[model samples]
Target: MSPNGIISISILALQLWHCAADLCNWTGSGFGADGDSRTVLQVRLRCTEGSVRWVYPGQALRVVLEPNLSYAQRTTVCIKPSRTFRGASVYIERAGELELLMTDGGRPEQVFCFRADGPQRPAIYLQASPQSDVSRPMVGFRYELLGNRSAAPNLGHSGLQTSCRPCNDTELLMAICNSDFVVRGYIKNVSHDPERQSSLVEVSGGRVYWQRSGVFEQEEGTVGASRSVSSWHGHIHTLLQCHVKPGGGEFLFTGSEHFGEAWLGCAPRYKDFLSVYQTARAARRNSCDFPLD
Candidate 1:
């Protein structure tokens, strides 16, 4: 069911089984979901097998297991909204060990836990109550299980547990040219955004090398919203968490003024191609206008 108390119109079932191609290892094979609304709910798995799948609202599912197999298998799943749309987050109100009645014969399966641990490993959690003023509350589940090492020895990983990805070169260039100012600075403060969907970070002790709108103090820092955690000032220079990429952590950054407010974007490092961005800056300065060169 969705957190808003809307009942799901259908359910989905995913089954794990022993694969003859690989011994002592379980393979995820079966998947079934009801309904046609692919936009309602989304699913993504890490270190496990499954493409991003959309689900119906308030959905339920029955999970079947092989009785003789050992209970050790590594699996992590993230249920959230489709990334193609505007930024949104899932709010889980309840989760943990669950007993399910199998559909094959309506037999009950033993409870298992899929909770993730450690900062590197993100797990879904149930808040006592809903957060205030969040626009993108989704119905999703997150779990991380480290199966018995001897049984499931080959759990490989590909993508990050979180949704953030590095920015491309064109995005970096566009961000540099369109901002009020671009600075290289360290993060001095960290707080939650007003909406509670992301973190607000302030950067200080950096120099603003470029400005388009007007004059600004070199000491004055700017803030950005991010979805990832930022390192403390001086310890690690990182991007201010902001809307362009909801989660903020250590990454190359470029800040621009939007609607008279400071906004930043995750960008590629200018140092990587020092001559390129430097040349672009010089061209802009000479012409007193934005130059593609």
Candidate 2:
């Protein structure tokens, strides 16, 4: 075989090696000859959540998400770029066409989400920008795949707009029953992050009925006369557009957890929730039995 033929065969073997490895977290470097700059490395990740890092990126990389999902259900994919992410642009490939998802110079704190429904399985493509120095920039992002049962409604765009609209009676009832955590709390503080376009709501939970994840924990310190020693404290994340405010009244906080972070869902004032719950209960329309304090 010619020397050039042998070099081509070697590159083909390297590409195949990367494609065959199913990993949850992938870290690789793209540094090679001029011909290798045109090579597109393929990576397959089968996990529901993971991260990908490309160091000194030169050639393009294609990431295929093949999480185990039910055919009858829909799936949502969300990616959060690392704060230090640089030197690459991300695109979603559907039907052999590319749709730009994140620009190389875009806000790193911002998250992007899209629906991965339909017959065509979506894949992420990372195209590296031209380099001028030997700075060795790293491009990376974390990803999560949410199924229909776990995904919040309308988790498109930034995935933070799910709580923009107030939930209706039926949705409210269902949220308390299906959410990861149900708490009776008051907003202690509300902080907005413009960079991420999100709001962080600090909650002082008086009562935690149930919590799938240990997101809310008991506060340590002297308890006030009106406060319970068993009171839990936690933060709930929501989009800044929701404009969450710290009010005086207690509320029934119900929400789901994503990637270990608690997200706000349907929250109604305690009194209003009681009125709704009682009315639904009397009419035999409540989704599930919720203990009242």
CA RMSD for every model?
A: 18.5, 6.8
> Against the true structure, whose TM-score is highest?
2
Clashes of each: 18, 0
For candidate 1, the 10 contiguous residues with the lowest summed lDDT are 101-110
Candidate 1, backbone clash total: 18
Per-residue lDDT of candidate 1, residues 1-293 (tens digit): 44443322234232222122122122221123343322222222233322222122222222112212243233332222222322222222223322211111111111113233322333222211223433432322222334322111122221111123554444455555454455555455656644323444565544455654443443323456644432222221122233332333333445433222343444444354344456656666321333323
Please list the C-alpha lDDT of all candidates, in the order they appear.
0.32, 0.77
* Top-lDDT structure, candidate number: 2
